[model samples]
Target: MNHEDAEMELTADSIITQRVIARPRPHRPVQAGGKVGAVPDAPLFLHLDAVTTILDSLAREEPVEAGGLLVGHSCTDSSGPYLLITQAIPATLARGERLCLTFTHEAWNQMLDRKQKEYSEELIVGWYHTHPGLGVFLSGRDLFIHQHFFTDAMQVALVIDPADFTWGLFYWQNDELVAANGYYIYGRSDQTYQALAELLTEYGVSWGIQTEEVDYNA
Candidate 1:
């Protein structure tokens, strides 16, 4: 089978369940230059539970980098297509260092096996990795991985700097990956997002910044 066909087969076999949560509206104001607003076609919605799980795993990794695959359900609404991340599966078998992480073939197979056996209802929506001291930006290797593995337009890349307590999401637009200006954090209460914002701000990493365009060619 071809690449697209292979992806479809993989997804069909792994994704066995779909959960639809309440659609979350953007709470933040739009930034100037139209760089930081919800995309009409595909907006990313991150679940608070997923964020907490990822943060916990990052904490466990400490100074070293950690990586994981995002598993969730993709849904659409009147606004457009949106992905709701419900789970974060840590790559425990990954080879990690202070500056880099490589997900081994064994890890990939194991994750796929678990997805098929346990999380048959969830799909691999994207990926996330800690940057440690580095800021929230995708490196050349990251771009390559996104292009090859996470080729879906709705797929996103999340970069978090545990040292700085900063994070950003990268999405595909106009055939290029660009930093998302805004995203929704849905949970039982708005206070969840408020507390997270406050914590990031206390760490000197404000989340309210304009979406900066990225140049993968650089």
Candidate 2:
């Protein structure tokens, strides 16, 4: 909302997201706070498809910073609000160096166009960026980008270290960024996560799945 952040704007595009949210059940809420919506340690449901895309992008642009938007639905339930990441679209036109990644207007516009044409109903729940060898944690510039473009309280910031293939998710907690200790990976019953499983184990990151449906009214 500042003059310097005016050029790149999410503008009043759309934030009414539940209309297309993915409802994966047998739910166990990953509550970060006592609130009823997204908070620190809030559950994040990531789809295999999205994870695959993220892995591929990170591999292709290794040793340099790269990034893109996280496409999905932001929904709240009996547990609270969780992000169901359904897709990962890289910013092919983005410019970057070892320590910096800039989401150019062209890159940003490209993502918006794809989201509208392909995943028209889904919201941009958050964003993910690679740190190459630098490791996970947002820099001042990264925070600025997230604060300006991904303004919603439910929105998240994911940092990935392609060097070690380690990653982390951060969300707002009383206007401060808080890291999640674990998350959930939801996908079709047939999908395999052998590769991701190894990485999660290596990093000591916990994950889960809710195969059964939840009965909220029960």
**Clash pairs detected, candidate 2:** 32-40
Residue-level lDDT tens digits of model 2 in 134-211: 877889988887777677777888888777666778887788877776456545654344544554444343323222
All models: lDDT? 0.65, 0.66
Clashes per model (N, Cα, C within 3 A): 3, 1
For residues 16-127, write the lDDT of model 1, one tens digit per residue: 3344545544334212112343332336667656777787676563587788788877776555557777778887777677777777766666667766676667778888
Find the 10 residues in a row with the least total lDDT in model 1: 29-38
Predicted candidate 2, C-alpha RMSD: 6.1
Model number with the top lDDT: 2
